[model samples]
Target: MTGDNERPAYERGTGFLLARLGSLTARSWTAFLTEHRLTQAQYTVLVALQQHGPVGQRRLAELVAMDARNIVPVLDSLAAGCLIERRPDDTDRRRRTITLTGGGNALLAAVADAAAVEQDQFLHALNATERARLNHLLRRLYDSHIPEAPQPG
Candidate 1:
């Protein structure tokens, strides 16, 4: 990877750097979340439910960026662990909503704190202002390119 060290700066494109960054972040998150026996996708579902309240499975899938088919197993794992509950939507019989249980909230809080440590370590080279700016730029790009996920009614 450092072969570019001798090459001109222009030779290494931003896309290549971005892909490397993505892999670095994923590995860091995987290590951190492993301690909690949670995958990043599972933690994502918990955090979304903790923040957004109960939501239909389809909406939860959208929120977590998981495919509609795959979210089920994550939900099942969480449900089996008693971290979440799947309740029938009162107004919509065909739909079910997922809610974080008290245990889930507690677990989420702990996991979030641990996750923050990983984030800090990963961005340690950046000063506060630069970190904020980088986050802002990423969010802007994501928001502009990705449509908002539909929310459960």
Candidate 2:
């Protein structure tokens, strides 16, 4: 049996690197977005809507990798801020579609600028080529996990 001070080989290797990288990235994003009065989740939602356009709530939740129930409060707050609107889906009244309002678009533009600056500062240790490689690897990892469509609720 290993003592408390001893870690298994895997724990001290790839697992440690992955955990540290994930935590650092998450913290950097949280701090950067919070400076603009947005949580990581809100920023993610806005980015998704910006990219995909008017999307159903469930689909939005999936795109952002959030639970449907958790997404409701975020959507509610965005709607209350006049950043987005929820309208009944033309095809399915039971489903609501979310779209960014002009205000939301403007906010997203500002946030995108801030995010770019934040990313530069966050990855200052990496060169342009390294950053590009890191981004490509991360995208591949995500694509391997998340499906193209939201799983039916």
Question: For model 2, how does the per-residue alpha-carbon lDDT over 79-113 read when each residue is reduced to its tens digit?
Answer: 98898999999999999999999999999999889
Model 1 ranges with Cα > 4 A deviation? 1-12, 65-67, 92-95, 150-153
Q: Distance from true position, residue 61, model 2, in Å?
A: 2.9
Collision pairs in model 1: none
Candidate 2 residue pairs in clash (backbone atoms < 3 Å) = none
lDDT of 1 by residue, 2-92 (tens): 5768877764788777887998888877888888999888888998898889989998888888899999999999999999999999999
RMSD to truth, every model: 3.3, 6.0
Best by TM-score: 1
Whole-model lDDT for model 2 versus the true structure? 0.88
